[model samples]
Target: PRRIVAGRIESGSLIAGDEIVIMPAGKIAKIKTVESWPVTPVAGRQGAGRSVGITLDRELFIERGDIIAHASAAPRETRRLRARIFWLHDKPLAKGDQLLVRCGPKESRATVVAIEKAVDPGELSSTENKAIGRNHVGEIDISLSNPIATDPYTENPRTGRLVIEVSGRIAGGGLVLSVDAGQRAVPVDIVPVESALRLDERSARYRHNGAVVWLTGLPASGKSTLAKALERRLFTNGGSPILLDGDTLRAGLNSDLGFSAADRSENIRRLAEVATHLARNGHIAIVAAVSPAREDRATARRIADTAFREIHVATPAGVCEERDPKGHYKKARAGALASFTGIGNDYEAPQAAELVIDTSTRTVAEAADEIEQMLKTSGVLFDEVVDLAANI
Candidate 1:
């Protein structure tokens, strides 16, 4: 069904045949027609400040909360925002407060991540505070559950102003200062189109449930070796398996990331997302990476949920350095590689891993056998019983 987007054009103009982009979702379409309150002889275009209704060339999943703009000049899509706000509620505004952030027609559930500073506008003074008092101004960081399309206040006032709602009532208003660069939009940030195939159908056909097998450890700790062996074992057993090695990902999907804490976290987040996507489609995702931080691994677990299986490759650092298949340990010791796990850096081992393997003493086949058995025990891998049932 065709939808007529009704709104006042804060700036620019919309003409028939003009390509427009729907924000947040990034759906693009052409303007098919424009309607005005006072019917004009020519209703092909509507200029700024005029309220009108415009229909697109084709139907899209547009909502009341979506912004329509010129495709070429679309705003940034981000979940993290920095803003200066005036708290109007009697209750103080505190960090971690849950609120609804509304900018024009778009609104999203948000959390006050930080209270950067509280200001007493009347006294022209400011101080660091955990909360902002009633009628006071504050600079804060807001994290949204979903990304919004917005521009900086200085750049476009129309899309930069926001209001906070607490308990369905307006509690504060703000102007967006900037968007966190690290939390900016990625190519996969658009709304997802669901697949038609059902998970149970895939499971019934494959005769097994999909899962993400995450192998995390230090460099040369035999993560890749064990991952390869496990992949071969799963494939030989008639299971659909895909291996996602860290080095290979770095050379492609994660090439933009580095060894910094933030980069590492982003790298793991992307890997987890990709692995989860694969697992959701009934494929075993075998991931081997030196995901150092427990927090990052936890995030991955949250992403993969019940499909996640964390396996800590507990190979000793001495043995890892000795093997140093890639000479990373020597480089780290020579100060050539900084923050190298098991050397210059620290690795937080999983406190509650599903399994722990010390490759220093175990053969590749042995490690793979243990993993396969674990999968069987967890019901992720189907056994001969399922095979016989399928044959029947």
Candidate 2:
């Protein structure tokens, strides 16, 4: 008979004669009687930090790592553990590696089944597996060598946990969140555009053809002007283009925000979300904004997906100042407006643009003509009609 050195509840509600289950082994036993403490026959729930000893009614068998749980709320057994691993190891974790895992007072050996994907903590993007270095968070799946009594992390954090230890050194830490049902992975195969479009017939009807034109540049740099011109051209050619101008959107959608860096980033993010919605509905969205930051633009590009086309209005700052139709430059230079882009703040030009228009050298008509030509060449527009004729 193994002598089990089990501790009693110091402060909670369990009392003598209550049925209990020893975890990990799932052994049941009955509480005999209170061995210590003046049995204060309290009526209400047990208060904090009151240690009480209990004698077992049967020859109960348990161990050091075993947990005493209420019989009604006994821990469930699980073989698979899905977790978000915070990788601290210099070397990335590979599948089929065996590691010692510890959860609270319980320990077990777990084998890595799959490293689904790595995510950046700052941006939360699924980074390339080869690019996953130290200090990265990633979702992973693991299979335990032995069946362990556990719960999902959402249910119990204390019992649902794991620590990866390799060669007596802690490599990473994670929490068990889900149990995976073995399923086959789908093979990567190209899907024909026609078949894909057939899946969403309403989207095709509304959008005509899925397309998104993202126009980004410095403030007063003619991004809105170019976008409007392009929209007109697209409309004349039987294309329904949705224009999302930053200034007009800010006036309504983001009126509460200021021109701070964080606010500007948020503004771009919201715009991206809106553009995604319009594009998914099958309308060609023409986004015109002085989206000054590269990171924000990258976020927009990612959300826009395959339909995204970045159009850079490469208007010079001096030229923009000269045409400052809103007098924003004078106000910014006079210190009346703070955090004004181009004058007092930074504006990152598009490193890669599908179409770059220098408004200084090109007129609005010429810019519009270039966009129409691009649409025709790209098969987005089928008609050879000029801008005026297309409008009719």
Q: Across residues 135-157, which tens digit of lDDT does each residue of candidate 2 receive?
A: 88887877765456666677767
Worst 10 residues of 2 by lDDT: 183-192
Where is model 1 more than 4 Å wrong at Cα? 1-76, 79-197, 385-392
lDDT agreement of model 1 with the native: 0.84
lDDT, candidates in the order shown: 0.84, 0.70
Weakest lDDT window of 10 consecutive positions for candidate 1 = 182-191
Best by TM-score: 1
Candidate 2 stretches with Cα past 4 Å from truth are 1-208, 383-392
Please list all clashing residue pairs in model 2, or write none if there are none.
207-282, 207-283, 236-390
How many clashing pairs in candidate 1?
Answer: 0
TM-score of 1: 0.58
Q: Each model's TM-score?
A: 0.58, 0.48
